[model samples]
Every structure is written in C-alpha cells, then in structure tokens.
Target: MTSRHHNLQHLKNQAYQDPLTGLPNRRSLGDYLQTALDRLHRHAGQAVVMFCDLNRFKEMNDTYGHTVGDRLLVAITKRLQAALRPDDVLVRFAGDEFVVVLEQCGSRQQALAMAHRLKKQVGSTLHVDTAVLQPRISIGIAMTSDPLTAAADLLHQADLAMYRAKRQKGDSVEIYDPVLDD
Candidate 1:
C-alpha cells in the first residue's frame, strides 16, 4: 500500500538517525553542515559551527537500559531545539555529541550566548518516560569570519573546540583557533 511505502521510507530515515535521540546521525550532520556552509559562502556571510557533547551520558547509559537512554536523548534533543534561535540548527553528532550551526552570526558574543543557553538547557533535569535524567553539555563554538572557509574546515574547527570543552566541565564554549593552519 502507498501508506505502507511512506511508513517504510520514514522508518528508513529513522534508521539513519540516532536511534536513541531521533536526531540526524553524524553522517547526515556532515552533509547538512556542508550545505549550510556552502549557502553561507554564496551569500558572503559567516557561519558558526558548534559542537556539543553531553557530560554524564555514559554514567546514565550504564545505569539504565538503552530504552531509557534513548528516551533521555529524545528529551534532550527537544530541549536543545527549543533553546536554539530560529536561524540556528541542532544535530545529534553521535552518542552524546551534537552539532549546531548559527547562520550569519554577527559576532562572537552571539555565538557565546547561544552556547551558554544550550549548556543551561542540557544541564537541566529532564523527566523522560518513567525516570528523571540529568545531563550537561559542553559547547564548542567555531566562527569563520572568512567566507571562504570550507565546510570540512568549519567542522574541524568545531571538533577541536569540542575537545577543548571536554577538558573542563559545566559549560565550556571555546572559539576556534584562528591561528591554526587551515
């Protein structure tokens, strides 16, 4: 049946998504980020790439079944989306990692504020299914003032900042090392 086909397609899309969170997988994140970067470049504007990794996900996952973990991820994803501005994007990069893009950010301050908001959102306790989930996200902000920075480079910068964020706690948001080689 036609309805069956539509359902199947939807299922297929979900399969590529993070089963735990129902957010786009890293594979799709790469594609979408690239597309956004390209569009920004064409428009001669800056793009802000942010990487978010949950702080206490592994502890929760080991303590609970994947079902509970998945539910928690879903709740976290919704919270992140709700916190983002209309022009920004939030993606599930991986297990506890997420990627966000702020199109045409006017300043580092703007990016900083977004990261702080995301950190607060993720840090909030969530009621997922039958349990409460506590988690925080470390945010990494990468801003490219140059319109020519390719998508791959933008991702690389965001990833580097993500590691910097992981070194600490609560809410760490670091700008990319502009001095680094491209």
Candidate 2:
C-alpha cells in the first residue's frame, strides 16, 4: 500500500481503538450501533447495547500499581474478545469498562443469554503477567425495536442496568426494564 494510504489507515485505527486494550473505542460504537439499528429496522430484527464494567480493577491498581493494572487490562481485554463472536463489536469505554453491540437477538431472553455468556467469561480469573487476577464484569443491556431511539439513550439504559447489576452481590447482568429506570 502507498505510504499515504498506510498513514490514513493508521489514523483511522488510532481513532477507533482504545490506547490500552487496542479494542474498538466508544467513538466507533455509536456509528456501528446506529448502522445495526438501521439494518434491524429494514429487516425486522432486534439490536442490543450492552454496557460492561470490570469490577475491582481499581483495587487491583491500588495494590499492584498502574503498570500491572495496565497489563491486567490487556489480559482482561483478551478474555473478553475471546468470549465473543467474531462479528461482535467491543469497545473500551474507560478504565475497565467495555461496551458490546449484539445484533439480531430475537428476544430479551436471547440477549440475556449472550449477556450471561459475557458475564461468565469476564467474571473468570486469568493470569496476567506474574499475578493471577480474577476480574468480573457487570453488564447492562438495552434492547430496541425502532431505529429512532437515540444511541446515547440506549447506552444510558444499558449503563443503568449495569449499575443495577453492580449493586447486586456478585457478577451480574441486568436488562434495561423501563420500570427499573432510575
């Protein structure tokens, strides 16, 4: 490829990727989710936005220092990516938080199933460098029928559900239910 083409590709990579995890950043999540929503609208499918957070990484950072924490983040990212379908979109939202876009789930149960898988994968402990770290992810899920629902709103709903999960004792995944909106 031409140097100019390479440079542009590099730039796009930087724009879409998280500096730490090398996963797609939230900058790309909006566009991807919007496109998925549009496709769902056309084909009569369902789309879900999942808010993911790695629990207790801050405590790890405090005990092990930032460098280990960074390595742990990368390892955690690897586990998350490995747990997902090849076509799924994963984003590093901040610190240890991630967002996943799941396409074409027929019902909230199906979406919840994916969420359960994610919770299981992320909740498992993995060895990072010299330290053995167990990181659990709390998930928030939002399902939409219409393309018109704002992307930010969908994310917000998922985030709220994730927070709800966090409030429960262990690794948890909660779907956005309007009644639970808080």
Candidate 3:
C-alpha cells in the first residue's frame, strides 16, 4: 500500500476504534447498524441490539483510579468478544457501556441465550494489580424482524430495557417490551 493510503487507514481506525479497549467506537456503531439493518431487510431473520452496562463500575473506577478501571474495561471487552460470534459487532459506546449488534439472530430466545452467556463471561473475577474485582453487567436486549425499525429507535429501546434491568437487579438481562416505554 502507498504511504498515504496507510495513513488514511490509520486515521479511520483511530476515528472508529475506542483507544482504551480497541473495540469499535460509537462512530463505527452507526455504520455497522445501518449495514446490519440492511442485511436484515434482505434476509428473513431477526437482528438483536443489546445495550450492556457494567454494574457498579463507577464505584470501582472511583476506588481504584482510571488506570485500573481502564484495564478492567479492556479485560471485560475481551471476555465479551470471546462470547460473541464473528459476525456480531461490538462497540464501546461509552464509559462502562457497550453495544452489541447481532445480525441474523434466529429468534428472541437466541438473543436471550447470548445475553446470558455474555453475563456469565463478564461476571468472572479479575485481578488487575492489587485489586481483585468481580465485575457484573446488566444487558438490555431489543430484537426486531421489521426492516422499518430505525437503528436509533432500536438502540433506544435496548437502553430503556437496560435501565429496567439495572433497577430490577444489578446483574441481569431484560428483553425490551413495548410496555417498557410506558
């Protein structure tokens, strides 16, 4: 590749990737969601959008400091990645928040099962320097077979569900229901 081409690629990566965890950043999520939604429109299958937030992460960060907190986020990212399929897009949406878009998911049951697997993988104990922490997560899932559903709307549903899960229990999964908005 030409030097200019390499530089452009590097810039794109920096723009789309989260520096702390090397996961796709929120900017990448918008593009990936559009593509995933398009693929779902052509194919007859359900796509799942999961909003995952780490429970008590703020307390951990405050207690340990950013260095340890950053390491913990990186560790959590690896575990979540390992539990997901290659086709899935995982984005580091914000601090202690991640968005996972699963394309071609078979059903709501499959999405729920995947959410359980993610919770299990991320709940494992971690040792970052002197801090031994047990990380937990709350996942909110929104599944859609309708091609008309906007990506932002779907993500908003999942975010609402996540807040419900966080309120009901610290580390749990909640599937989005229309009633959640009410």
Q: Against the true structure, whose TM-score is highest?
A: 3
Instruction: State which candidate, 1 or 2, has the greater lDDT.
Output: 2
Q: Compose the digit string of candidate 2's lDDT tens values, residues 1-182.
A: 69999999999999989988888888888888887788776777678899988888789889888999999888878877887887678889888889988767688888888888887776666776677887888889998988888888889899989998999954788888897764
lDDT of each: 0.78, 0.84, 0.93
Ranking by lDDT: 3, 2, 1
Worst 10 residues of 3 by lDDT: 32-41
Q: Write the per-residue lDDT of candidate 3 for residues 70-153, one digit (tens) a residue.
A: 999999999999999989989999999999999889988899999999999999889998999999999999988888789899
Better of 1 and 3 by lDDT: 3
lDDT string for model 1 (38-70, tens) is 776567556889988887788888887777887
Estimated TM-score for each candidate: 0.82, 0.92, 0.96
Alpha-carbon error at 92 in model 2, in Å?
Answer: 1.0
Model 1: which ten-residue window has the lowest total lDDT? 173-182
Q: How are the candidates ranked when ordered by TM-score, highest leading? A: 3, 2, 1
Clashing pairs in 3: none
Better of 1 and 3 by TM-score: 3
Runs with alpha carbons beyond 4 Å of true place in candidate 2: none
